[model samples]
Target: MTDETWSQLLAGLTNVTWQSLVMIAVGCLLIFLAVSREYEPLLLLPIGAGAILANLPLSPLVGEHGLLSVLYDIGVGNELFPLLIFIGIGALTDFGPLLENPKMVLLGAAGQFGIFLTLILALLLGFSREEAASIGIIGAIDGPTSIYVSGILAPHLLGPITVAAYSYMALVPIIMPPVMRLLTTKQERAIRMPYSQRQISQRTRILFPIVVTIGVGILVPFATPLIGCLMLGNLMRESRVVERLTHAASNELANIVTLFLGLAIGSTMGGEAFLRPATLAILALGLLAFVLDTAAGVLFGKLMNVVSGGKFNPLIGAAGISAFPMAARVVQKEAAREDYSNFVLMHAMGANAAGQVASVVAGGVLLALMAG
Candidate 1:
């Protein structure tokens, strides 16, 4: 070979390192989980694809002015995509169950205990306050909120934190049932909470978003963008006059943004950036946060049982940590195992919705606490 061609070959070989190969393997593993295991396919798939692309030998995706970098600046770095996604989430959530039972808000508040507890633990393990706070938010189990908070708090740690949050969220069905069953008595689980389907009027549904946006904005201004966008989506759904916009927001807009956001986030996971002992520690801390959040929520439910003269089932408490319908459904399944006739879906859903809001507020609270 000519000298110039040999030099070019050597340069290319030098760029292909073990770290990149390992990260590419990790990326493929994420894709396998999403595809074969059906664990958050929508997100993990795109994320895995991005990781592979970014780690490719001599790829331009992570270079200066590259597509991933540009997308990151336009969406995640500026904190635009997550806010947009929040709007879609809001439009999709039915707050009627939570509105019908405002008392469930307390359970949601209880769910945030793990965020703070995990924060302290992470700090002790040598992470910076901001990094620890971001890691702790994994307990919230709300992907968008975790992204929003971490985007603002510790942007550097966003990729792993977001992945950990969503991964554990998909695992809620597996993680929560054993904890729920262990904490509650079979008698308690058998106590039936019938689905009380209250017909929430269009007016009420429309007003709910506006009122919550205003209320939450006043209480926690940092949550305004996330809450406002979410509520706007719900308003579109309830108004029933903007089906096009609703469809676009929930389906089209959300899908496009998810793709861009996942790619941008995955680019941040370049081998040199992600192959740290700290990354493993963050993953471990995230799992700890998730388990503690469940424990705290269940314990609070046990407290409510005492206060309510054993009227409330502690299993519903497991729904308090913002994993949404998944955690709620898990609770329902656990309840059914003890007694086939018992169905706590509605009540669990109420706590689940409450958790959704509480997690945003908790993120804001963490931000406020740390920023101060």
Candidate 2:
């Protein structure tokens, strides 16, 4: 064989490291969970593929001019992809439920308690304030928000934070129930909240996004970018005149950006960056944040129940995290398990919708606090 051919043959093999192999395995595990367990398949599958490609010896898909790097520069680096995703999320979200039960906003605010709690814990464990804040956002269960915040505060930690945020988000149904049951009694679970079908006028619906954009921008200026894009999509959704735009934002735009974002994120999971003591701490802390968020919401719900003379179902508080309809559905399912006749779906939906907004604000607040 020619000298050149022999060199080429040995190049990839010689470059291989145990770190790369472990990362490849981690990537495959993510892929397995995504395909077999159907855990956040949209993001995880692409992330796994990206990780594999990036770790390949002398991969052309990495480095300064590579596609992954370009995607990272264009989207993740500038925090554009996550903001774009938020637009789609806002377009798809239904605020009518929250509008019907304005009081549910309290539960949404309560849901964010874990982010701060986890931030303090992370700080105590020797993480810098910025790093801890980035880690704390995992509690919001809003992957886009986590990405946006972490990308700014501790960009190096993005891979683990994003993974933790989405992974726990996927596990919301599994993780929340135990905490809910442990915090509340069977009677609280069985409490029925009759759905109030309040007539939310078209004007009110149209004004919500606009008012929120202005209000949040003024109050939490750092959050304006995230909230603006989110509310822009929501405004398009509620405008009715922009059905085409809304549909595109919620479907095509979201899907395309999601693909790019996932790949960019996965590319960052190179073994040298991902395998660390801090990474494990991030995962553990992220889980704690999620649990604490759920616990705080449920405890607050219990308080509301007492204030309402036992009329409020504390399970709805468990829906106050940013898992959207899924968290709300889980609450309903749990309530039904206690008593087949109890119905709290609508009420839970209200809290869930409120949580969606609350998470965005929480991300912004973190940014504001961390901003130099």
Candidate 3:
């Protein structure tokens, strides 16, 4: 072969940087975890694949006008993907639990305290305000909200912040139990919450999303896009007339957008940006935020237990984050381990649903505070 031809053939190998190789390894690890552990495979698998594709030596996927870049511009840049995901989340969400138990909203609100606390801590660690705010949203464990907020405020740190959010989200089943056990005794863990079947009227169900969208939009203007899309899905579901539309939103639409969103986010994880000391700090801070949110929720549950004269199960407090049924399921599993007869799943779902809405509001609050 001619020397010039050989150089052209060797271009990719010669261009490989240590950073790119390391990122490729990281991508493979994410893929392994997703496949073996089944930890959020829907999003993680695509994210890992995108990371690998973007980091390949002399790759064109993330170059100007490339697929990844175009996806990023179309969705992540304009904050379209996350909003669409919220619609799917809303369509899939059953607010009956939360509506039946309105007081669970307080627990959801309490769960978010860690976000602001982490924001303050991130600022203390010398991160700029926008970056710190973005870091703190990881506590919510709502990947879409994390992406939306970080994409707008701290685009530079979006890679780490997105990974931290989704990773902690998948780890909720693992990370929250210790905090629940540490904060509560066996007796507290075994606290029983009987399911109450309140016949929430169809009218109430229809009005709930509408009321929430208007109220949250009025109160937290920045959250309107997130809340609006979410409630639109919920509204479709509750309306009961748009079964086809609802199904499409919750399934087909969500699935496609999730793929696009994950790839766009992963494309941002090039090693030159992701391997910095700040990445480590973001990961550590994200874990801290998760722990703090869980602790705060359980502590608040303990307080409610006191106020209710021990009628409330403190374990339900642990579900007051955006992990949805997973967090609630974890709480129920922990309670069952303490006493097989204990059933807190319904109550925990109430708190979980409330947390879903609360996390979006928290993201908006952060944006409102930091948008200046």
Candidate 4:
């Protein structure tokens, strides 16, 4: 072959830069974290693979009409994937425990305190209002919600925000245990929350989603889209008439969207755009947001515990950060550490579920504030 043809064929290798090499290494690191540590392999693995592909020069996968590019445009760009994922989440969520103990919603709201706090921090650090709002949402600890909010408010920062959000989400088991221990006494951790089984009628369950959809939609207006889809999935599951649809939404649909969502998110991790000072700032601020979220939730739990005469277990506060069953399981583990008989998983799940709702509401509030 002619030298010109050879150079063209080896273009990707010949034109490779240090930045590309670094990003490829970072991709390997992501894969390592997924495989070795089991840190959200479903998300991290696809994201890591996509990152490596995107970093390669003249790579077709990230260019126009490329698989990753098209995926991003169809899924992340229009903000469809996260909403679809919400349906599956809603289908899986059970609000019974939350309804039985409505007060636990306070813990959910408290968990999101970090989003606003971090907003101010990001503003102080010279990020624009929209950008700061997007940055602050990393505190939600719900990857889809973070992506949805940031995608709308600051598209440029989506890649970093998503990485921070999901990375910390996977580390929830690691990050929250210490916070729970530090913030509460052993006795407080052992505090038993007697499960008060409340019978919620099918009517209540059906009406619950409708009521929430209308109430939150009217209140936060911007939250309508996120909450609406979530409720739709819940409605489908609770109705029980659409068994096939519910099962599909909760499993197959969720899986397909999640895979594409991860790849789309990773495709945006081009080193030229991603490797910057702002990216580092986002990483630091994301951790700060997580710390602040856990702190606020635990402190709120402590206050509630005092008011309730020590009936509340502060460990449940860590569940308020919306890592879903993972946070609830961690709370249960911490409770088990104190006394094996203490089963706060239901209560923790309640708070964790509430955190999911609160985070979306918080995102809407941020959007409203910025829009105003």
Instruction: Quote the positional error of residue 251 for candidate 4 in Å.
Output: 1.1
User: Which portions of model 1 show Cα errors greater than 4 Å?
Assistant: none
In the range 251-363, model 4's lDDT, one tens digit per residue, is 99999999999889988999888999999999999999998899899999999899998888988887888888798898899999999988999999899989988988887
lDDT by residue for model 3 (1-372), tens: 999999999999999999999999989988998999888988888889989999999889998998999999999999999999999999999999999999999999999988988999999999998899999999888999999999999888988898888888889989999999999999989877778699999899999999999999999999999999999999999999999999999999999999999899889999899999999999999999999999999999999999999988898998998788899999999999999988888899999999999999999998998765
Better of 1 and 4 by lDDT: 4
For candidate 3, the 10 contiguous residues with the lowest summed lDDT are 187-196
lDDT of 4 at 139: 91
Task: Report the C-alpha lDDT of model 1 over 1-372, residue by residue, as the tens digit.
Answer: 999888788875778988899899989999999999999988898888888889988888878888988999999998899888887887688888998888999999998899989999999999988888999988888998888889988998998998888888888888887777777788888876656677778888889888988998998887788778878988898899999999999999998999998888888888888888988998888888888888899999999988998888898888898987788898889888988888898998999999998998888777778778
- The residue pairs found clashing in candidate 2 are none
Task: Put down candidate 2 lDDT per residue, 8-70, tens digits, no spaces.
Answer: 999999899999999999899999989999999999998998898889888889998999999
Model 3: residues with Cα > 4 Å off, grouped in runs: 1-3
Q: TM-score per candidate, in order?
A: 0.97, 0.98, 0.98, 0.97
Instruction: Write down the lDDT of every candidate, Cα atoms only.
Output: 0.87, 0.93, 0.93, 0.90
**Model 1 clashes, total count:** 4
Candidate number achieving the greatest lDDT relative to the actual structure: 2
Candidate 2 displacement at residue 92 in angstroms: 0.4
Regarding TM-score, does 1 or 3 come out ahead?
Answer: 3
- The better-scoring model by lDDT among 1 and 2 is 2
